[model samples]
Target: MPQITMSAPMSKFSSFNVHDDFVYKNVDGVAIKTAILVPKSLKPGKKAPVLVHMHGGGFMTGNRLFEPWFALWFMQWAESVGAVIVSPDHRLLPESSSEDMADDIVDFWSWVHTDLSAEVSRVTSGATQVDLENIAVGGESAGQYSFRAQLSITNHEIGGFLSVLSALTCPNAKIKAVVCQYGPLDYEVPWFTQPNHQRSIMGAPPAEPGKPEAVIQDYLTRYVDVEKIAVRTESRVEELWPLCVAYAHAGKLAEALGRSDKVMPMRLIEKAESLPPIWFVHGSGDTIVNPDCTMNFVNKVKKLLPQTPMHVSMEPGEHGFDGGVPLDEKWVQDGLSQTAAMSSKPGEQFEVRQTSTTEDYTPDPSKSLPLSPERQALVDDILALYSCQPTIRRVERYTADCVYDDQFVYANDRYKMAGQWFALPKFFKESKNERYEIIKNDRDLIQFKNEQSWTFKLIPKTATINAIVSLSLDPDTVDSDFIQVKYHKDQANDKDYSHNGFGFQFKKFQADNVVKLMSSDEVKYFEKDKHAAKEPVKKYGTGDETGQAPKQDF
Candidate 1:
């Protein structure tokens, strides 16, 4: 067992008190830390539900404390929902393997149940207690793996093959609900096995026996070992049997790596009946993790546990969409509220609710329209100059014209600007400074605002702007290139944006093919009657990403 220590609440914010310190570790003395948010409104004798959230970093890097905006975002959420939020620090790769990280989570969570519950008085001084009956665990990206491992290992402890075969009784690690945001539930899927994804999470690749890159070699060795086990699954190879088999084998590998269970979640589906309700939130435009990953997991879980209460929110934005702007602040609050609400009851199930929101970049180009190639080229040229690049990547071209309506608000003033190519420079000049500086320009969004704040006026003034871009196949007569811009000014002489804020959705367009509802009743019926008669939709990707064998990228 690893040592456990916790610090006192760091801040005296009105709604919650924040605390940070190491929670648990392995025999190797590698300690994992936690940032806890405890609501102040709780009665001294009563207990509060616990939410153990893991941060997103593709399993390679990330921490409990994020950037300024996200930090405030988490704190405000804890304050708003009035729950005990525990964000544990999982060790990153190179220094720790996936197995080791998962072990840390299990150990940390176990310690929370036994040790922390006993010593709750030490941290809270008996003012608050941790409701041991209700515990919700969740994360984003790599963090989601932590939840899977925590649940899997805990499930195994309660009564999986080893426990049942050995006739051992393990204490139940109570979990009330789960919240997963933009995470992959299936690692064996080809999307993750690719060189790029592998490099990001498993480290630079080309793993072989006795390779110089020891980390990559170890990861590959473990992965190969799991693959071999997956091939031996007794059930149909294409079904969930293979996925569960691979995870079971991963549990063996985890032990070899000095841990408890694998960082895979497919096996957990089999135990859905024993698990709590789940909530999933994802961005449709997330390419890094792919929305399909979440969609697939949700679909599988639904098929396995159809009557299980589940909630999903698919919004239009890139990764980390819930943060970064004011409009999204509501989305974050909704997610947090859902988590708190779900955790309120330990045994009851809720109905499944699927909700989604899209920005100006509608898939239906006929409504918003596109610009001609020549016109788009000119817009791209302007953006290239602003981005300080010679030319924009053609592969990153945008086809939809900008949607400039009442979506933009600056210091209480609401104005609509048309023609994104032309509105951009004009909006730049609206700043207190005569000229605006373009900080970042990418295919997804563009960031620009005032530049003279650093010079220091008698009363300093500044602003930061972000514009989410929209692309179409080819623009013919579209006049505007602007989509939606969230502009904020520190001293803009207006009340609406005296602080920082964001906005979107000037005009609503029906979801295009890519982001349309897949699990809807009509779609499912259509698939069952029309599509099921036909062949399965062929999945495709460039190069070896076509779900074939691993492409050796040594």
Candidate 2:
């Protein structure tokens, strides 16, 4: 593979203002420094989201200024969002032990909460303030010598990033999202512990054509006498990049990085409490770290915390595949679409530059309001009621005598409302609130327009309903709660339209299906007898059966 050389990040983002060499922490007399890049479009006093990026240098070299290793799409996305970029230069390996690097990560979080705002304010000349609420941590591969190090691919970043999740002492520092590209995050995988014959760097022959194990031993012997060499100049760092891959090829990577349990994030992942939305991109053809690392990490995260939204973008190319490309590629645009989907949450939007493939959605700016805590909770509950969230409780949100009429099913009380609502999943596998607009919210009435879809469980067809609703508050509890929907009239939005054949048909079909699926037997979760023999779940494919059945049956 040919070397992908990229232009300076400053030149690409020319409109961005910069501040170089700001010290964030002092560790054992070493002043850990960081570089800040502020977008010019960010106006004065306006809040800006932050992107904390850790540079990739195999945990052995490269400062935070190593822009070539940065992902092209992510940087451009950050620029489009007017994000303040903070790239820290942490302690490198051989110079610092695994514990030291982990400490640096812990300290980095503390610095982010206490001093990051003022530091950014000074950097951008008070043009923008850091929005601590909306923060993302991202890094390119710096793990595995072949370009799979994540925190970017090396043990330093893997340990460091995990340290933030598992060992972080700071309460105020929270990361809303994470973006990792081509990382070997799992140390227990055979790739890190087992030796490999292919000593090539991204399919290129090694500098020394000898056996990988011999080459690794030779390199280890040379560095054995050297004490810690923390920070190096740029050119030297570049030279050291390819050289680090030898240890990984010979299966000495973990041992070389002090062989500490801290380097293994697989051990730490289960301990993470607050999981953030993670975005992972890997080159399918990557010879260094390989895509399995990313897939494994994503699978583990999903298994541990399935609710955390994750997007794994796989492109065709070698490691650093997106080094010199622009942000318009299909993979990049797909990532942008995922970001757009994430924007539905109130303050967790990372709206990036979109390509032509993505559909534009322009919500009415007039309706946007800063809701109070109670009203926000009401909105959340209302959205949850429609979104088919697993955790929704109808009794907690709706009034005892609330009326719900969708033409097919009618309920005059919260008890019946829950029965009809819970019956939704029996007909459809998924129910989603596609587009919602609150028409009115007051003491007497609360009204909204909702466009939603229900996907059939057995068929491939999907039904979209254009529903308009008006809510009447209960007089007794309305003042105390401010949102007790005593009556909810689900009106059809398309009935009055001049030509609504398409819309009316969808509503009719979905409503009819709901009525068909509403029998208590189909939705047995709300009512099931413990003594009754369980219904046998139908198997889709032909299979052998071994489980027991009661002998009383005829």
Candidate 3:
């Protein structure tokens, strides 16, 4: 556990400017440290939204300045959205209680609100920046507990010991959003399976063997002192306990008594009706804090505050999504590639096209062709293209006919239906002979669907395509679908590329026809004649007629 020492100020992106080692003091008069990052190009006179972030360390160890990735990712996001990020380091445990930890957070907020108001005001006034109304708080692991405590103080639920400082310091404080990443919400659950029973059998703290009944008696007698114990014993007549001498030991008695009903009891704090939106991210494979803890807490919170927007992302990694399993550089690379592909410059679009030689042309509505070896190979290749690794599951797939489907299964799993397009790659290496014609084109549309799905529409000379994909278990069946492939292509230009793309709707029991097409030219040709009268192309586009090439997925 090396202490965090700030070396040099670094910038993550061009827009994000960071300052390291910003120190602030807590109410206890401890000099706590923090890292502050601000977006450089903000409009003058506007209060920008700010995010206060806490790092995860199981409540025992961690520093804001040391783990720069947490601040870096947050600052990058803030800069992208023109917001500010503040990350603070709180005092660690053994020296601090949960109460003291909560107090430290409130103190940090107080300093930001009052002591640093001039800096905030300068940043906001000099540039039309910062939406003061839209402040957010977030943390990972033990830090999440602190953030939760902050929310509890805001809701007036069992007022945190630090609430007084918060009221005096940041009376106008209002958090718009909260994000918790793999945090422990409950403490009472024992270190072993049967905590309570084990405690009783183990005979309390400073626990030693052969000291059961003696420990209990000494604990009870010390509250009234030795004289009272002797008087009671004399009246009872017969027995004089040999282990009674330990009763006079105040430290032992205190430790024994402290282990009584107070240690790690399950407690719930009632939330306000207008609680802020919450975002939770955890790993399903997390062995440390069970993912159920997050869902359970969310359920309880929603029961009290139904309107609070809650979102959860259970990634493939283990606890903290960093440790345990060996890190997969390919997964990291793929994520980076996807992120880069999603972010396109203004007026630029990326395009992809896929073609196959074995169409065996079938346009007849009622005809069904027997599977040939080549056709079967084509089908296998296409299916193989959609397959994912054990780590990567297919959560959803959408077809062109506005129908969603996920019928494919591997390793006792099936996918769900999503309306947006997404892509999920298999972890296993593809065979040399296996091939699937897949043309996925992506462009940043003005508006996008929240869920994974597929969309296709014909423009005057082009067709708009969109899809959403994700990795999630099937809601109906608890089957694993870790990968999602969403394909959307913009076909506004009547360009002739010898490619064929087919879409299908699949179910657990039956396969349904969605849309199967050979080329965009054929799609356009079908739209031309009244005699043809094919399915009318849906009217959906960003309304910007400028033809931008679709993004190609590599």
TM-score winner among the candidates?
2
Q: Tell me the tens digit of each residue's lDDT in model 1 across 127-243.
A: 877776666565532211122232210011101111111111112556666666666554445554433312222111222333323444454466454533211101111222122
lDDT by residue for model 2 (1-554), tens: 00112343545446567788887777657688888888776656657778887776656666776555556665666665667888777676654666776667777777888899998877666767888877777766232333433213332233224323322233356776667767666655677677775655565554444466665565556754457543432234435654566666766666656645555556566766646666677778776665777787678878986876677788887766776565556566545445333322311011111111212222243574445465656666776777676332443355433445454544443445556566656668888887666656665555565677889899998888765555665432233323445555664522211112444445435533553455553234222111111122222221112112111100
Q: How far is candidate 1 from the true structure (C-alpha RMSD, Å)?
A: 22.6
Tell me, what's the RMSD of every candidate? 22.6, 16.1, 18.5
Q: Across residues 37-61, which tens digit of lDDT does each residue of candidate 3 receive? A: 6777654443556767665443433
- Candidate 1 ranges with C-alpha deviation above 4 Å: 1-16, 40-43, 67-74, 140-171, 196-261, 325-554
Count of backbone clashes for each model? 13, 16, 53
Query: Considering TM-score, where higher is better, how would the candidates rank from best to worst?
Result: 2, 1, 3
Candidate 1's TM-score reads 0.43
lDDT of candidate 2 vs native? 0.56
TM-score for each of the candidates: 0.43, 0.58, 0.40
lDDT of 3: 0.35
Please give the distance, in angstroms, between residue 282's alpha carbon in candidate 3 and its true position after superposition. 0.8
